[model samples]
Target: MLQIRKILLRGAGLEDALVQFYSGANVLAGESDTGKSFLLECINFILGAEKLTLVDEAKPYTHLAVEFVNSNDETITLVRPTSGGKVAAYHVPIADISGSGQSIAPTRKGKSKGPDVTSVLLPFAGIKEARLRRNVEGETQRFTIRTIESLFLVDEVAVIDQQSPVTGKATFGDTAQKRALSYILTGVDDESVAAGEKNEIVKARLKAKLELVNEMLQPLNERFASPGELTVLTDDTELDTLIGSLTGELENLATTRDAIQERSQEATRNILKADSQLLGIRELLSRYRLLDERYTSDLDRLDFISEGSFYFDALQEVPCPVCDQIMAPGHSHGPDSTALPIRESAVAEAAKIHAHRTDLAAAIRDLEVRLGSVEGEKHTIDTELKSLNTELSRTLAPRLEFTTERLEQLVNRHTEREATRVERERWQELVKLQNDINSSLAESGTPKQIWAGIPPKELGEFCAEIQAVLSEWKWKGTPHVEFDEKTFDITVDGKPRQSHGKGVRAVLYAALVIGLLRYAAKNHRPHPGLIVIDSPLTSYKKKKNQTVKGENGQIDAGVEAAFWKSLAKTSKDIQVIVIENKEPPTEMAAEVHYQWFAGEEAKADERAGFIPTKSAPAN
Candidate 1:
């Protein structure tokens, strides 16, 4: 049994009354206006109910308080002053389950610790960030408990002696209604993939940026702008080290160019000097050769002229000494003697001079010919040297320049790569940091502190379980429940309707409660502090038994009485307080006995004056 220590009532139109109450089901039976409901209202006031309704003529309660003992025998009293409203409740701590003060604040006491009332009330408020978001998204709806009470309460289920409002456009017979029940039964504070999506987006953006930077950093030919094609490559060594090799190559080219130019210049100068020397030698040699040819011809002519002179001057002459007998002269002499005395010194000197001149001319001619050959050879050498110099300048110089140009390009390209490397490193680091920051991102993109206490996955499972129970009822459509960080969404047949029919809504409402309890049980979670069901058997379908019977059958009760019985059976683990106008199910109410009497203390309705207890309906 759920233990109840005492009940305190003040200004409920009653001056004096009992100071305690019986636990379990406390049935208040009295006259219609004799504080029967006030007793129940008193329980709600201390229970943190926000909405309070009373007749204008009837008086209001000044104060209401209740005491409850826990399993550890510690007592706590929840009190609410009428002026402060039901939401404003104060607590009183006691030593034991009995009415005795002990601790100052029971909830704050360290002994027999439980969850903070804030955490407990956090779910109860249903004003969490998730719920608010859902409400804005138009999923289920936005509501506070106070507003919920204005629409439906246990009083509507206990309709007797009068008919009540069947349904309204925005009544409890809507998807929002079922969700309200879900919230009441189980508090689902948070459930939405907020941080997950944000993290992914951040990662994607980082990757894109890193790729773009890497591509631009690459060498000209291998570069790419497209993010898909760009790939970032990393190397341990820096480009600065490679500069030495290029410098070495440039040095070699410069050296070779200098050496070739020097050799070419030397060859040119040598050829020019040799030509001048040969030219002088050739001039002297030409003069000598001409002299030699003239000398030789003159000698030959002199020999031939001597022979002719002998023939003309000397005629058949023998010896001049024996010419005494013969009168003929051996040789006719014209003004000259045959045996004349010669000028010996003049002849000898002329002969020596002639020989010396002839020899000198021959030697000069030989030297001139040799000098001419040498000069021609020098010309050939000069031409070869000039051609070689031209070849070096035309072919090798351009090649050297080409090498220079290529080296410059290589240097420039490498310089670009170096700069790119530095910048790319920054981008790479940013990408890594972005990844880390995004990893710490929350599930719903909100701060973890706000929703960390909520088990969104479990709440989803609870909704699914409720959907399972609702499957039995044939609604206009299938009913579904969805809760996110913002709000809850309920659908019938996978589609949203403005509202649901009375009978369908009632099924949804029950399913919601069953789902919550089932979830808690399956997960072995703590559930509501208390549950009160008034007329749990009340339904809104058209009465089948009230209609005429068909040809072959009577009627099929849409809801089997066994379902409620099963419900009561399963709800045993929780503190379920039920009051039924009709008999409760056999499974749950089997052992519970209810005694009835028609006497002065019997509960009465407004029509009691017109109808007596014996004439009243069985209910």
Candidate 2:
């Protein structure tokens, strides 16, 4: 499913070398001193690793270049080492790669036409060809790859053999070199990226993440997450806690408010009591004023009578209407009262008595009026105070309590989401781990037949299948090569172990990767369709670690190899490229197109090692 059209290199084992490859399997082989490994480096270079390589004779300043063609007829050219006296790069038309009649001409600064090239022949190289598009004359055009495109390349043997300081078995596959492929996906420029850049990148990414987290929490702070996001029980508990804290303060406030209201009511009650007393005093005052007014009116009448009494001067008994007729004396009788000689003193005394009575009437009326007004004002004040007390006690006070409750509810909602997020994240992780374990078991030769009654998601059933597989294992005498689900452990025979020997471990690892891939594929997860392996097999480095070769272990390897062959055959969509000096299963090899690079054509660093490039065992 994957093909290598060609690879080109400069200044490695060879000053200038290029190789063309078509589909099938290709092998590069050479004796220890030849350029086999150097050619491999060249492949890595052309694919996209950008390290300025130490080439033939250690020409550290040498430039590098590469080219490739894809199945879609797209040609890619790459060149690099441009700076530091290396000035590199140039591109050509696709027609040139197609071997057509058209030729490419180099343009100066601004040009109308551009070239096309984007693929990487290998994954790690020092050259790059990045495609850039520009709008010229209102027309869309694409630029050529001025740098190498990264492709997959493996140099395990050379890596393990290196004695260099930086060559301690890499924790990661050639980092700077592998960056070519990463660039395509991440748009990162290799030259711009430094070893220390990851820390900064991660920090920046985290900063952005934190900002988003803050924003999300801000809205959820208002209890605004969706139904799935907001957990009811969790929310309620959180609400309860928040409410509890606020309720204490609210309760204290309630006490203060109640006391204030009580004082206000008592003031009103006192005012009412004072008003009642004042009302009585006011009634008395009103009667006094009325009596005073009446006294003035009666005094005016008495004054008129006294003036007439002085002018009369007739003898008494002149008009005795009820006594006798024509009686003439110094006395006058009127309205059944007898009057003697008119006297100023008597008139004055009568006026005084009349004024006294009138004054009493006026005072009584004034008191009555004052009392009426006091009663009305007291009634009004009582009503206003009642309204005030009712509003404070019932409306505003209750509203404050309601507001407190709502605030607590909101706080609780946010806390619930925080907890839910933690729980869901953990739950998802556990599920993923459990699934990974089950998947590993399945790939470790645990058969579907043993797990036939179990569904795919049933991890417990899968674990049972694992136990069953172990119990039925043909090579059960050793200790912990088999896995245990109960303890999340592994054992070989009767001995407990976490990992196994290289040969078995390699198979196990392969099983692990494969099983995971299968599980993902079945569950509709995304997976790449290609795998590249370099020096995939080696004789056991430790003799004591070897399992009996003639036993079921050998048989299992055969079956596993067969399984790979079948997978390769059936899953034509996937491509598997494995490099090894050891012979593969003949049956599997027969189904693959294979080639071997012999003589001076193996790795890219061979020529750079200063060995005579021409002095190799000729095929």
Best by lDDT: 1
lDDT by residue for model 1 over 182-289, one digit each (tens)?
Answer: 443455532441322344565465456546644544543243345642454444255445556656766886787788777778877777787777777767776766
Model 1: residue 102 alpha-carbon error in angstroms: 12
Per-model TM-score versus the true fold: 0.35, 0.32
Error of 1 at 289 (Å): 99
Error of 2 at 374 (Å): 99
Error of 1 at 260 (Å): 99
- Backbone clashes in each candidate structure, one number apiece? 14, 95
Clashes of 1: 14
lDDT of each: 0.45, 0.42
Q: Which portions of model 1 show Cα errors greater than 4 Å?
A: 1-8, 11-44, 47-51, 55-61, 69-74, 83-460, 467-500, 524-527, 533-536, 539-560, 585-619
Candidate 1 weakest lDDT stretch, 10 residues: 159-168
